[model samples]
Target: MLTTSTRLKLQNICSRLAQGEFVSLQERVYLQKFAERDRSVSTWVSRAQRFQREGTQQGLDGLMADLDLGRRNPDDPEHPEDDLGDWFSNASPWLRRD
Candidate 1:
């Protein structure tokens, strides 16, 4: 488990990444270290990278929601799987089969 401070710092880095801000090499290395140890952090890092590449906040938001991060609603009763179709359709072209 990540310490609370580390998790907070990671979140800050992710927030900056989502906003198209550049992170320092040291910050990148820090994220890389934690990402290697934590699946969730790895997913977050990948989504942040995708956001940087695609320049689409919607896609990032959807992907993050799928990961149960920054979810807008807890009682909305909508399963994350309910949006899998949309997610797959919006995935990067290289990720698609056709």
Candidate 2:
């Protein structure tokens, strides 16, 4: 959602970085104008990396199966009600004991 001027400035910054240039005075000034946005991008990248690593370790199928099972049927006996601690306490009666 960068403005046209901001996007042009970012493109310039990236081009400079690719050429092994650190922030020059003008680039630094533009960056300061968008410091909060840069910080959020960095934070999101960090979180995404952590999530990717953890998800890979768990396997994609494992993650999907977990998500798929999150929904519970209203008519299912395993549905718990009243006190959460006591909820599903009688699930064995509603589900196959085996």
Candidate 3:
């Protein structure tokens, strides 16, 4: 099993790698090791290849778009205007202490 730190290291590398950012040899090796333990890491790497092929954004943004989650703005007109920042930002019936 990979340690949490190793996984975190791999996740960071994965994001950079996906974004077409430069990564060092050591980081590549670490990623390879991480892939050995995690199928998802390899999956993300392959997904990056598609982004390159399509000449798309090729990063987290592209990934989100591909995943159909591109619209992240809470203020978007499609969403309600209630602008509740967080569950703790205000109290709703669900959060009623009484």
Candidate 4:
């Protein structure tokens, strides 16, 4: 379970994301720390990134509503270990194949 402060910080970061604001790399790393413990956080972060990438304000609003309602995507993995490889690749985008 997430601590109250951590949950609040997460909500704040996610809210900024919903508004299409720029989140610094440090904040993203902080989010990643919590995401390692909670699959729901990872799922919402992915959704937020997709909506942002698509430039869809409506999608962002829906994401916020879902967050407020504590709703999570059904497809999100129940176990963090289930998606460890995906998480590692996403976490280190700066790495190069060459």
lDDT of 1 by residue, 34-56 (tens): 99999989888867766655465
For candidate 1, the per-residue lDDT at 42 reads 85
List per-prediction Cα lDDT, in the order shown.
0.76, 0.50, 0.65, 0.69
Candidate 2 lDDT score relative to the true structure: 0.50
What TM value does model 4 have? 0.51
Q: Candidate 1: where is the Cα deviation over 4 Å?
A: 57-98
Q: By TM-score, highest first, what's the ranking?
A: 1, 4, 3, 2
**TM-score of each candidate?**
0.56, 0.31, 0.46, 0.51
TM-score for candidate 3, residues paired by index: 0.46
Task: Write the residue-wise lDDT of candidate 4 on 7-94 in tens digits.
Answer: 8888788868867998999998999888887987877676665555544445766676545433334345663334556656667557
lDDT of residue 32 for candidate 2: 51
Off by over 4 Å in 3: 55-98
The number of clashing residue pairs in each candidate reads: 0, 0, 0, 0
Cα-based lDDT at residue 45, candidate 2: 32
RMSD of each: 12.2, 13.9, 12.0, 12.9
Comparing 1 with 3 on TM-score, the higher-scoring candidate is 1
Question: Against the true structure, whose TM-score is highest?
Answer: 1
List candidate 2 stretches off by more than 4 Å: 38-98
Off by over 4 Å in 4: 55-98
